[model samples]
Target: MRIAFYGSSLLSSYWNGAATYYRGLLSQLAKRGHQITFYEPDAFDRQQHRDIDPPDWCTVKVYPATDEGVRSVIAEAALADVVVKASGVGVYDDVLLLGLQEAARPGAIRMFCDVDAPATLAELRAHHDHPMHRVLPELDLVITYGGGPPVISAYEGFGAPLCVPIYNALDPETHHPVPPDDRFRADLSFLGNRLPDREARVDTFFLDAAARLPERSFLIGGNGWETKAMPANVRHIGHVYTRDHNAFNTSSMAVLNIARDSMASVGYSPATRVFEACGAGACLITDSWVGLEMFLKENEEVLVARDGVEVAEHIRTLTPERAREIGEAGRARILKEHTYERRGAELDRLLRNVAAAKRERSAA
Candidate 1:
């Protein structure tokens, strides 16, 4: 299958959280003998801070976010077997959505891949007249990163024929145990882009934890957090590159997973960092949310904390041997059940099934 994916930056993880998701899924899909082309805009600073060169498995084209640029890409995308217009492209999303829907035309499978389901669905629900609602009935398939019954039902209610949740998973080949980097060494760590929806949660789960455990060393990494006030015990590293994720994870005694407001409320969503940290053999402590048990067992594969106090206790009380045990257990679970290869296979099956069902309907 030849797949065309239009998404946020693929070569950089600068302000793009979906980069890891796209790279993992597409890389595995390519390994399975699929031809993939990724289309991303060149407007973001990602191009300036690019951590990697273009990957060999797939073609990545960075185009201007202009009318002419989109037209050229649309024509090329229309030729593929599947055309995916993913969420969080960071610019002209409405225009892109309409263009992709038009490009899909009579034959190509049209997909809306929502990297942020809670926010996407919430917008659709809050405003029935959202531009997306106008195109919802026409999309052949709808997919999301972190969603469950609530999100699926909402998308279906908005007129989607089929909506599926393809949660974040590990890509062990890219993210696994590595020797800890001295620069990132800390008792606790967190890495995430700063977004309005997530800052408050980060403050609660990460910053507050640092304050409560004043003696413990805390490290923060990612963009947009440089200006935030920090405790003397906390160290902030701006913009940790994708290449350094494993070392960043391994260097910390335990890493934190703080959910954004929308994702936290939605409940089933786990950020890509969660899997990456676990894959790197980091003991994981995550803020509380519903449906967490479905992904990782509480206190066995991961530790769940509801507030900064709980987070402090978890970090302070964990013995080194016990932490390593939990990290190993988490890694085992991810390798067995949640890898990009498994996700790619699941996607392949779903696409085939959808195509077969469509053919039958047409024949009838």
Candidate 2:
């Protein structure tokens, strides 16, 4: 199958957290002999700070941040067997959606992939005049990043003909354990862009934990965290590249997962970091969230912390032997059920089903 994806930056993990997710899924799909082309706009400073070059498996075309550039992309994308316009494509989301709807030819499967389903659903519910509500009926399918039942039901209720979830999973080839790098060595580490929805949780779970355990070395990696005042023990390493994720995780004794408010409320939505940490064979400590156990077993595979005190205790008291045991268990679980190949196979099945159903409808 030929697939075209219009998403946030695929070559840069700069401010775009979805880069890893896209790279994992699409690269896996390409490995399965599917032709994939990714179209990303040269906006949001992504091009300026790109951490990765063009991938070997798939073609990535970076377009100008102009109207004509988007129109050209839509025209090219409309010719594919499947075209996906993901949420949070920086400034051109509405324009791309409108153009995609106009340009898509008959029998072309057009999907709106919502990487930020919880926030998207919340906005659609709150604003009756939301543009997406007007465009929902035009889409062939709506796929999400695991908001579970609530997100699926809501999208369907809002006139999405079909809604499905393609959960985030680990890519072992990119994320597996490697020799630890001394530069990123930490007693506890957290790596994520400082988004508005996630800052509070980061403060409560990561920063406060650092404050409580002043003697323990804590590392924070990602852009937009340089200005924040951190504890003396905490080191802020701005914008760790995707290539260094394995080293970043391996160097840390334990890694922290702090979900955004929308994600935590929706449950069943594990951050990409969770899967990466597991793949890297790192002991994991995550803030409490609904349906977390669905991904990793609490206590046995991962430690759950309700507050800073719990995070501190987990870091301060967890023995090396116990940490290794938990890390190994988590890695095993991830390998068994949550790899990119698993997700790619699932997506292949789903797309085939959608195509078959479309054919049946056409024949009728």
Candidate 3:
């Protein structure tokens, strides 16, 4: 199938958290003989900060952040077998959502691929007049990167015909163990764009932990944290590019995963960082959330903490040998069960089934 995906920037991970997720899944889908054309707006300085060139696996179409640009891309995207409007396009999202639905060719599979399902669902449910409510029934399918059952159930409640959760998985080729780098060396490090929904959690899980373990070194990498005050032990490195993600993960004794408020409340929504850090064989200490056991074994493959105190305790007690043991176990588990190849195959099967069913319906 020729899949046209409208998403956040794929070539840059600057402020776009979904870049790795898009690259991993779509690249694997392309390898399976599907042609993918990713449509991203050249907004948020992403075009200037591109970490990777247009990949051979998929074609990237970077359009201007204008109404004309949206129309032009939607018209072209309608030609594909599958037209997907992913969440958080960062510009004219409403126009893109409704426009793509109306513009898509008849019989073409129109999907809303939501990267942040928990938050999206919250908005839709809280506001009956939400634009997504208007678009949901028109969509052929709803797919999410994470949010296991709660998200599926919520989307179905909104009268969606079908809702599927394709959890985040590791792209081993892109994120694997590398030699540690001096710049990133720390006892515990976290890499995520500072966002409103997640800042409080970061304060609790990362910053507070750093304050508690003042003697130990800590690292913070990602954008939008330049002004946020932190302990003297914490080093703020703004926006670690995708190229250095492996080193950022490998150099740290432990990496932290802090879910945004909505994701943590909804449970089961694992950020892309989880897979990337674990893929690099980093001992991961993530905040407690439901449905995590389905992805990685607690204590053995990952260390779970409920609060900053727990996070501090984990860092204080975790020996280098033990961290290595957990990291290796996490990496091994991810390679066996959560690689993008596995995710791509599963997605291919689902897409084929959905397309076949649509064909049967049309015939009927």
TM-score of each: 0.98, 0.97, 0.99
Task: Decide which is better by TM-score, 1 or 3.
Answer: 3
Candidate 2 lDDT by residue in tens digits, 1-364? 7888999989998889898899988898888788889999989889988878898988899999898998889899767888889999997888888777777778888899899899999998899988898789988899887798888889999999999888999989889989999999999999998999999989999999899988899999988887898889999989888889999998988999999999998987998999999999999999898878788999999999998999999998988798899999999999999988999898888888899998999999
Best by lDDT: 3
Question: Global lDDT of each model?
Answer: 0.90, 0.90, 0.93
- lDDT digits (tens) for residues 84-193 of candidate 3: 99999899899999888888889999899899998898888789998899888888899899888888999999989999988899999899999999999999999999
Q: Which ten residues in a row are the worst by lDDT in model 1?
A: 100-109
- Cα deviation of 231, candidate 3, in Å: 0.8
TM-score of 1: 0.98
Residue-by-residue lDDT tens digits, candidate 1, 178-291? 998999999999998889998988888898999999999999998988789999999999999988999999998999999999999988898899899999989999999989
Clash pairs detected, candidate 1:
none
Order by TM-score, highest first: 3, 1, 2
* Ten residues in sequence with the least summed lDDT for candidate 3: 70-79
Give the per-residue Cα lDDT of candidate 2 at 266: 90
**How many angstroms is residue 200 displaced in model 3 relative to the true structure, after the best TM-score fit?**
0.7
lDDT of 1: 0.90
Q: Give the TM-score of candidate 2.
A: 0.97
Write down the TM-score for model 3: 0.99
